[model samples]
Structures are given as structure tokens and as C-alpha cells.
Target: MAHDSRTPSVPPVRTQKLRAAVSSRLWPIPVFAVAAAVALGVVLPALDQAYDERFPEVLQVYLFSGGASAARSVLEAISGSLITVTSLTFSLTVVTLQLASSQFSPRLLRTFTSDRFVHWTLALFLGTFSYSLTVLRSVRSGTDGGTEFVPDIAVTVAFLLAIASVIGLVLFLAHLTREIRVETMMRNVHTETAATIERVLARKPSPDTDAAAAAGSLSGPEALAAPDGQPVEAATSGFLTLIDEPGLAAVARDAGAVVRINACMGDSVIAGVPFATVWAGAGRFTAAELEDLSRRIGGTVTVGFERTNDQDPAFGFRQLADVGARALSPGTNDPTTAVHVIGHLSSLLCDLVERDLGDRTVQDSDGSVRAVLAGPGFGHFLSTAVSQIRHYGMQDVQVALRLLALFEEVSWCDRSGAQRHVLQAGLAELREGIGQHHYTSAEKQTLMERYQRAQAAVTAQRGRPIY
Candidate 1:
């Protein structure tokens, strides 16, 4: 593809991923373990030398009397206790992963694995064990009738660490038990989804005459006809997780070209397919230059096998929706869990209704449109949150009733005209599904009454009948 001289100087997606991976919980255990071992190795020896060579004749009386044997005994005890605690921690983590996978969506395992508490707890236990063992080797026993060197300070510090490890173990147990609950999971997902929305939508440009004019010009025929531009094929096959907008805009602005994104976030793209098309503007570049630009553009877009919550709000919605669907499945048949999920979805939808969504158009400092990227619309999120549960739980009267109540509550919230229409359409679909399915007359009437209340709520908000 032709390189856009205008593309900004944004770091590639891989670089960003690398930075995040380095800071993840996966590294803390090993990093802390090494630090603890090295610190004790150096500090303990220095302290021993200081006490032996310098004064402190009064302190020598308080030093351990059993010589090397006492130091060895303390070291053995600390190692044994830490090993057991570490084993217990691993066992609990594995059990929790299994339960979260079976009870909720398997995707939630990532959240558990990345938990900082789990990482720090394991790090402390292993770190303490390593420190004690290193110090154990330094304990020296003098010959018979000679002075006995005990490394008293090292043993004292090791004992304190052992005490801390025990406290950590107790806290880990309490935390693990609470982390596996459904309410906690729902709340965490909700918070993440909200944060993603705020982060992504905060960049949206306010309406401006110049920006609108630029948007219009970019959509014109001449701009669309990029005979000079080349097709930039995807390097790998995976879901497009994130796109660096500012970087792409800078590239386009610098290259004096326009870039159009073909794949939206959360979309799975195949290798060798055109993920984006770049058209060279007034400047002309050679094939080699174009290739380099293609590589740079590819770097800005990330493709991964699985969808992540980092940039895709839809994934969060999918997770919450999946929980509700699974609960309503025949094997589980837990409507109460599904109902709780619906309440969460209602709150999320309410927040989204007040926000603007669509193609994210990035403008240059001069108010010219440089890049346009695709994002999920409000309707897309609504369908993702409601469609699956509506289909799977249609036969159950309680599920249907609660679904309608969700719609009613959301409709009552202050929302734009378009958002209200989406809610009305959801209500209509539910009423149609209930009508098509076999329901007792009383059951059907009960559902219809709830649907009417939802419809009334919207109509009252709009000052006219929505249906």
C-alpha cells in the first residue's frame, strides 16, 4: 500500500502490548523473588560481619547459643511452612479457575489470572523461602571451644518474613472466596465496560462547520478514487483488537493522503485481506516506500486470537450477556442469576444511551479529517446484551417478564430519540417472541401487561406513541 506521509508518530501496537505485558501480574512473582534473594544475600552477610568485627560485646550475650544447628533448624522450619502455604495457594487458584470457567464464562479466567493479590501473595511466600535458604548457607560454626557464629540478625529477619507470609495466606483465602462470587464478577465487568466507553468516546470531536466540511470532502469521489494508493493486506489472522487513531491520522496528515479502515474493532480478519486502504495524495512514492508505510500502518493495528476488554467494550457486554444465557440454559436453569445479569445490563445500557457512537473520525490540528475508524453503535451493544437472552429464555415466563422490566426501566431513563427507538424495538421483539411461543393465556397476559408498561414509559418520554 502507498505510504501516507501524513501518518503521525504513534508507537506500534506491538510496543504497547509489550509495555502492558511487562507490567502484568505475571512478572511480579519472579521479579520479587530475585530481589528478595539478592537483598538478603548481601545485607545479611554485611550485618553478620559488622556484629562480629565491631563492638556489641553486650549483644553477643543475646546471640543464639546453639551455633549452626539452631540456624539450620529455623531455616528448615521456614522453608517447610512456606512450601506448604505455596502449595495451598496454587491449589486454591486452580480450583477457582475451574469454578469460574464452569459457573461463568471461560473468558473470566483472564481476570483471575491477572489478579494482583494472587501474584503478590505467591511472590511473598516464595521470596521468603528463598531468603531463608540463602541465609542458611551463610551460618558458620566455629571449632570446639571457639566462638560460635550464628548470623542472629539474618535469622530474626527470616522469622519476621515467615510471620508476614502466614498473614498473607489468611488474606488470600478470604479474597479468593469473595472473588468467585457472581455479584463480584458482574460488578467488575460493569466497571471495566464503563471505563472503556469513557476512554474511547472521550476523543469524539465536537460538531464544527469546518470538520463537517472536511468530512464531506473526504467522502467525495475524488478522494475515494485512490489510483495511486495500494491495498495493505493484513499480516496475520486474528480479531482486530485495537487501532492507534492519532498515529494513523498523523501518518495520513504527513503523507498527504487519506486512510480508510476496512475492519472494525472486534472483527476477525484473515491474512492477505485488505484491512485498510491508503491513497497517496499529491506526493508520489516508490514501491519500497509504500511497503515501509504498510508495515508502519500494520504496526498501529493489533490482531489477536481472542478479543480483549482493553479497547473493545463489546467484549464486556458479550461476557455479561453470556453469563445470563448460560444461567438460563437447560442444564443450569438458574433464572435468578440471569435476572441479576439483566439488571447489570440495564445499567450499562442506560449509560451508553447518553453517549455518542459511530465512525470515529480523527481530525488534524487544522480541523481536516485525516482518518475514519469503525466502532460499535449503541444498537449493536443493545442487541449483544439482550438478543441472546431474549432468544434462549423466551419460553420461561419469569425470564420474559424480567426482560420486559429491564426494557421498561431503561426506557424511563433520559435518552436520545434514537436510543428510545432501539429500546422500543427490543420491546416489540420480546412481545412478538412471547406471542409466537406457547404460553398460557394468563401468562401471556401478564407478559403483555409488562410490555405495555414499557411501551407507556417510552411514549411518555417522547410525548407520542412509539409503536
Candidate 2:
């Protein structure tokens, strides 16, 4: 019944762009490392010959005049050692890849293994080809053979650089992957905390807007307007106002409290809907108290002008007397009183019910009856009864009788602590008005009979001990 309507403000486009920029900065390290690896391994090979031709004299010292024999033996030994080392390194890398894949994902392992099978098979083929090249160069340059067809120094340097680059890329990728995993974990924690707060707020009493109110103020979204060209509020400390049809307000006050429980300020309270306004300080107490206050008021439509969210200590709710004084001030003659709004709404709802039920004389075919108790018929009758009961020191009797009558007609009523306390307080006031324990003999006898009859009926219904 109470709308906790708050608009959800859209996040700024600039904020999204900033977030994207930060993410790009964090994730680009892997890309740069891969690019460097490509340059060192693939690009350097094409530039080798130019650097080699420029260093021909250096090559001559290592290759000419019987020094070629020693160079040949050393080249054979170095090439053989490199082949063994690269093979061992590749095998270890494959083992590491399998272990990592199994730890994280089996499907990933299957894909990686399938793709790398061709790479490993091709590398093996190239190793054999390079070995054959080495043997051909040795054969062509043996003894009196010329340096015209020999392998250049650039080829050896390029091959070593390529292997080292591949190793570096693999290490860099591992570091980037760990960083991404950590970032993901932190994001999930923040999301879960936000969701938990939402779930807890959804179950309590107060306007559903209370959740949004928990976030910010109602003014940020669809703010309610007060009548008489002034702000209608309960208390300035930390309250706002909601105005709606009088009829709708009464139903929410009496039967729709549950609906409002989900609403908070900064929440969605639709227009043309009736609601109660309540004031709260900062935390759960204000929210809990508002629920208690609404229950005490019974069937009246109430505008709970209260803080939608947590409030500052200096600006929270003050006493009602203070509020009334503010209302009486010359600058603001706001006729929109909280009590008036509630009373007006209550009257409207009662009028609607009277119209629906018709006069007391109208009876249903099943012997069930509805009495319109607002206007001329039972309305005047009950008003007179209230006076008579008050004059005779029988307020408890009047209240009990009215309650029984309501129970017979209505299917249910809220039995919240605040509502029951208000009813009991009303009975006490009536007793005080007529002087307690001052009933006449005949009145006492009548009261005793009514009590006995009511007890018997209750026992029959419950089919158990009254206690």
C-alpha cells in the first residue's frame, strides 16, 4: 500500500569509459610481451644476412687457414649441445602445460594439446633439417673447400634468439593470467556484498523505498508534493511526505502494511497510490518504530514523513510539539497536518465501505448482514453508544462489544503489538473518564453475564482449556 518509489539513476557514461581505460592498462602487458617475442624470433631472422655481410673479416678469422677444421669440430659440438638442450626444454614445457591444464581445466588441455601437436611435430622436422644443413656446410668446406658456400655467423645468433624469445613469452603469459584471476575474485566479493544488503532490506516493514532511502533521499527521484503549496512532512529532522487518495490510504494503513514494508526512500512509489509517511533517525530503530506507529493508528491512512535513509544526528526527528510550533509560524501556514491527512483518508475509506454495504436494514439471503455505520443509521447509533458508555464508566464494555462486532463481520484484523496497545490505551482513558470501579449493581450483573457468555463461546470454538 505504501510506495517506496525511488528512481535508479543511471551511472555516468564517463565512469564507464574510465573503468574501461583502467582495465585496458592492466591487461596490455601480455600483448606487448607477445609482440616483442614475435619481433625477436621472426623479424630478426630476415635481417641476419645484412649484419653478416658487414662482418666478413671477423668470419674469416674463425673460418680460414686450417682454423676451419677446429671451427668445424666446435660447430659440431655446439650444434649437438643446443639440439639436446632445446629438446629437453621443449619436453619440460609440454609437461608444465599438461600439469597446469589438468589443474585448471581438462577441456583446455585437450584443445592445447591438439593445437601444439602440429607445432611440436613441425619443430622436430626443422631440427632434422638444420642438422642436415650443418653436415652439408661441413662437407662443402672440408680441407681445401672455399668459404663461398659456408653457413654465416648470423644464422646461429638468430636461432638462439628465437628459442629465448619463446621462453620469455610463455613466462610473461603466466604472470598476466594470475593477475586476471585475482581481479575476478575481488569483483565477485563486491557483487555478493551488495546483493546481501538488498535481500535483508526486502523483508522488513516500512515503505519499500526504505531500501533506496538506505541508499539516498527520495528527492533524487519522484518526490512527493505536499498540499497547500508547502512541503508536507511529519518532522523536519529526517522525514518526507507522500500524498495520495484518501480511500487508498485507509486500506494501506489497515491491511497493506506488508506491501509498504518493502519500500524505502529512493525507491519506486508510484503516483496516484496512497501511503503512510514515517520518520526514522539513521538505523533500524527509526524503521522499526515507524512500523510500530502505523500499527497503533489502526485503520487510518497515515503519511509517514520520515527519513528515507540513515539520517544525520543534528537533523533527525524532534518531538511533535516542536513540529506543531513550526507549523504555526508566520512564514509557513501549511494547513497540511499529518493528523489531518490521516483523518481525511480514514473518512474517505469509511464512506466508500458504507456505500458498498448500503443501510443496516438490507439483509442477505443467507441471513448474513452488513451495517453502514458512518452516516445516519448505525453511525449515529454507535456515536451515541460511545458517549453513553463513557458517561457510565463502561469504556471497557464499549470497546469489547465493538471488537466483538467487528470480529463477527470482518475476516481478519492486524493484531500487532502497537495496534493492541493503542486499543488498550483507549479503554483505559474511557475508564478514567467515568471513574474506575463505580458501576451500579445492575450494571455489574449485566457485565458479568456478558463476560460468561463470551467465555463459553470462545471455549466452544477453541475446543480446549481457556487458559
Candidate closest to the true structure, highest lDDT: 1
- Residue-level lDDT tens digits of model 2 in 115-212: 33324333432343354334335323444654433343434543453454355445535633542342222232223323322321222235454454
On residues 1-467, what C-alpha lDDT tens digit does candidate 1 reach at each position? 21112222334566657644654445666576758776875688678777665647776565544568878898889988898888889889989989989988887776777777888888888888888878887777776676666777778778888989999999999998899998888888888788777755543234584365555546423454556656778989999988877778777777776677878788899988888877776655578877777777887788888887667778888989998998988999988888899999989877776565666566666556667677678789989999999999889888898888887777766443557777778778888898889989999889888888778876665423355
Which residue ranges in model 1 land beyond 4 Å of their true spot?
1-19, 22-27, 51-66, 143-147, 203-230, 282-290, 462-467
lDDT of each: 0.76, 0.32
> What is the Cα-based lDDT of residue 53 in candidate 2?
61
Judge candidate 1 at residue 242 and give its lDDT: 80
Q: Compared to the true structure, candidate 2 yields what TM-score? A: 0.21
lDDT of 1: 0.76
Error of 2 at 380 (Å): 65
Q: What lDDT does candidate 2 reach at residue 289?
A: 53
Candidate 1 TM-score, true structure as reference: 0.85
Error of 1 at 240 (Å): 1.7
